[model samples]
Target: MTTLASVVSCLSDYDPNALPVAQAQAIMRDFVQPVSGVARVPVRSALDRVLAEDVLSSIDVPSHDNSAMDGFAFASAELASAAGEVSLRVIGTAYAGVAFDGAPTAGEAVRVMTGAVMPAGCDTVIPQEFTQGDANTVRFARDAVRAGDNRRLRGEDLARGSAALSAGRTLRPADIGLLASLGIAEVSVRRKLRVAFFSTGDELRSIGEPLDAGCVYDSNRYTLHAMLSRLGVELLDMGVVRDDPAALETAFRTAAENADAIITSGGVSVGEADFTKQMMAKLGDVTFWKIAMRPGRPMAFGRITSDGPNSQGAFLFGLPGNPVAVMVTFYHFVRGALLRMMGATDAGAPLVPAVSATPIRKRPGRTEYQRAIAALNDRGQLEVRLTGQQGSGVLRSMSEANCFVVLAHEQGHVNAGDTVQVLLFDGLV
Candidate 1:
């Protein structure tokens, strides 16, 4: 286990109060350990779950040579000896899931549908569109198709005992189809990660509750739920924990005991009067940080543990209270860390390049993620522009935008037509 102290001691410039965004990300990445447990699930049930082990094929995919499409299966030998256009007498029709009766001779052919097993001696197929004649007599130019064209050989997709899917893959819909193709009814996958989350503040209220003079409705939990759900982690919504030290500690303990990770919004900033910080300090190894990034400067990261014999433990992410900042920090930092915790091998998406449509003011020392709309212009050039006001509390901007225009830590002001990198909302999809 890598202790928090050990990890920090290695970094010469480690400053919790003014940590660089990338440095904070690196610390969390090094600290988290993937939870250990495997579940045997049906292929369909394994979608979005991480594979526990590499899946070896029990049998060859397709099992035999098959036609790639509706075509005339024939031996390619006579085509090479022919002078010009070639013709063959069709012996029989071959439909999908059914094989032709016997091998076609030197100049004979079989009308084969898509996925039909190729005849014993046929090594090539001429698509029906390329052939000129009807079923009884198939004719086409001699040069239309070459040897072994349009024929899918046995074990072409996956050979018996070969690896069909590697370990640590986050299964997708296509992966399920592939498993089904291999006749794999079940798979061993990492169990879904349980993430317990809540909002910590004295002035936050849930929906349907009467608004007090100083309190606003708590939208952080809802956003957190949606964001965490997208990662396929099972969520424990602990609702709003009061600013009291005892309540905060209880929430922290319960979350650590039951979940793989504890995500809380608010009460991590330096000026918050709540005992959340004190409770965190009394818990397991936790570190408070003011990351060098816009909107989401104040945050916390580490692990917390429960008390007594059970003594369950979980990684903790204390995000900022602002609605936009919560989402921004989650995407930039926590999302990747949680993926590592679940044993997923996917490294997420890369930021795409786009030309800025307008000038933007920026400084050199901090990274900024301005919610922006990116689209292709008339010349098919990608262009990005900010979504109205860029306030951290302005959740509407996040709603209206499609991507974040990421300005680097050392990047200065951006002028119109200057290129910038964008993190698209649909990159995962």
Candidate 2:
């Protein structure tokens, strides 16, 4: 129920005409809320899903004290009186799945494989490699081991009734293994977010369509599909809508009715064919119409209500028409917004530090995301250089680059060998 006006009024330097990247990010964080849907799924199928509730361990992890390695287990008290080397009579051997039937007596030792239950009276273990042993006896220096060396205690990994995983955690592969270790068959997780996206512009055509004098194939939708797929969202590709007002309105309404979010890649800029802006204003609350960022200056954010009776409205992200602009804007804004809506506790990836390989000119008033390639130099330090062209329409630059060189708003120019922030796209996008 938080209104955009209420969120904006509280900011001291609010400016819709030239919104700073940090301020826009803050507004997004304040306005969007997590989805409330939850479902139970098998632990194997819960990877990447946000946990709905905390999972507490029902039993001790190891269930009992066990041997951590192949060694000789015995009481450590006898070592205190040893002169130089301590030797003990070999009683029996314990395998991983088996345990010694009885405790070893004083001056006696038992051979134990890794993961074997420690004998009842045993308090220490000397690794097999550290001891000179035969079938009947074991010999080692008195100072070879401490009292509790090579001993794993019960519940050392996960104690009973303790939280194994917390709510809002996006399950990783290691988390899945942890769940399996705890014998968890299923887990409650947030349902996948339903997102409907499309591109706008009469000049843009689908792949199979014939190209006219001024038309080009719409690459924005395909890029959106690839990025959204990586996010694991249920995507509804609405195809390409024209620049006409009626078409734009129909697209917006349909997306609002069927999706939790709507992403349109055109008609946000102040151009002659920008009917999407008008439709957005008419449909719902347009939070901000401009941002002080290069390649993606004009954008739109709204909470559009559908005509359907039970509709709660979908969050709208009207990105720029240019291919590179769409990508940069989506990463900087839409990606985090969608993660918040999906109930993920992760704050996204951190910016990595790297040295700039070449001098670059930049203005001081706006943030810039320059596509670049980064690699470790001969000195074992990360160095980054920009791709050929950084124009908004140069989709080739984005495809050829491995990371983005992020220049801050107040940052003016970069000299050669200057330290800059980089965000790698390997697993992030």
Candidate 3:
């Protein structure tokens, strides 16, 4: 129910003319709320889904103290009095699913396979490679292993009754395996968020349509579809709405009716032909901001009310039109907000520090996200170099770069070898 007026009234020094990047982010954080819908899904099907509740371990992870390696297990006391080497008689062999029932005397050892429960009274394991002889008897160097080594203690990975995963966590492959280890066949997770998006431009045409002299194919919709698909949201692509007030209004209303959030590329900037701005004002209390950021300075954000039978309202994000600007704005702004809507509790993507290979011209008032290639230098340290083209319209720049070199709002010019923050495009997904 938060309107632009209410958000602005709360700020002491609010400036609609040129808002800071942090201020815009703060507005979004204060306005958006996570969805409350929940569902029970199989653990394997919960990958990338936000956990609805904390997962507690029903039993110990290993369920018993086991050998961490294929080795001979014996009491640590047996090696205490050893001078040059420790020798012990092998009592019996224990496989992964089996255990040695008989207790081992001080001079006796038990052959234990990896994941096999430790033999009774055994507290250490010497890998077969470190010991000489067969299951009958084994001898190892006195300093081969420390006392109480190579034995995985029961409940060490996850103790029974302890929280295995916290609420709001996005389940990954490792998390799924951990849940399986704890005998969790199903988990409660938040439902996937539905996002409706479209492009606003009269000169844009779909791929199958014939290209006019002044019109180009609408690449923004395809890119948006790809990007949004990667985020695991249910996407409702409303296609390209021509630059007409009536058409734009219909598209906006339809998006608001069907989606939790709506994204549109183009028509937010100061342009004579931009009917999107006028129509957006009539439909909702959205605010158009010229943010202190490079490439994507103009953006529109707010909630739009829908009057359809099943419709209530939806969050709106009007991004810039340039091919690269759409992606830059999405990653920097829309991505985090969408994640919040999906009920994910991740703070944000981590910034990596790297040495700049070339000097960068920058001002102190605007944040810049320059596409760059980050790689290891001769010293095996991460170093970044700018992509060939820095133009916002050059979609190739995004394709050529592995990361975005982020220059903060207050940052000045950067010299070569200067350390800078880089947000990687790959990994950590």
What RMSD does each model have against the real structure? 1.5, 1.8, 1.3
lDDT string for model 1 (54-112, tens) is: 99999988799999989899888968877788889999988888777888887799999
What lDDT would each prediction earn against the true structure?
A: 0.91, 0.90, 0.90
Model 2 misplaced stretches (Cα beyond 4 Å) = none
Model 3 residue runs over 4 Å out of place are: none
Give lDDT tens digits, candidate 3, residues 66-174: 9999999999998788988998998899899977779988799999899999988999999999989864889999899988999999999989999999998988899
Tell me which residue pairs clash in candidate 2: none
By how many angstroms RMSD does model 3 differ from the true structure? Answer: 1.3
- TM-scores of all candidate predictions against the true structure: 0.97, 0.95, 0.97
Clashes of each: 0, 0, 0
Clash-forming residue pairs, model 3: none
TM-score of 1: 0.97
Model 2's alpha-carbon lDDT is 0.90
Rank order (by lDDT, best first): 1, 2, 3
lDDT of 3: 0.90
Question: Model 3 — which ten-residue stretch has the worst lDDT?
Answer: 1-10
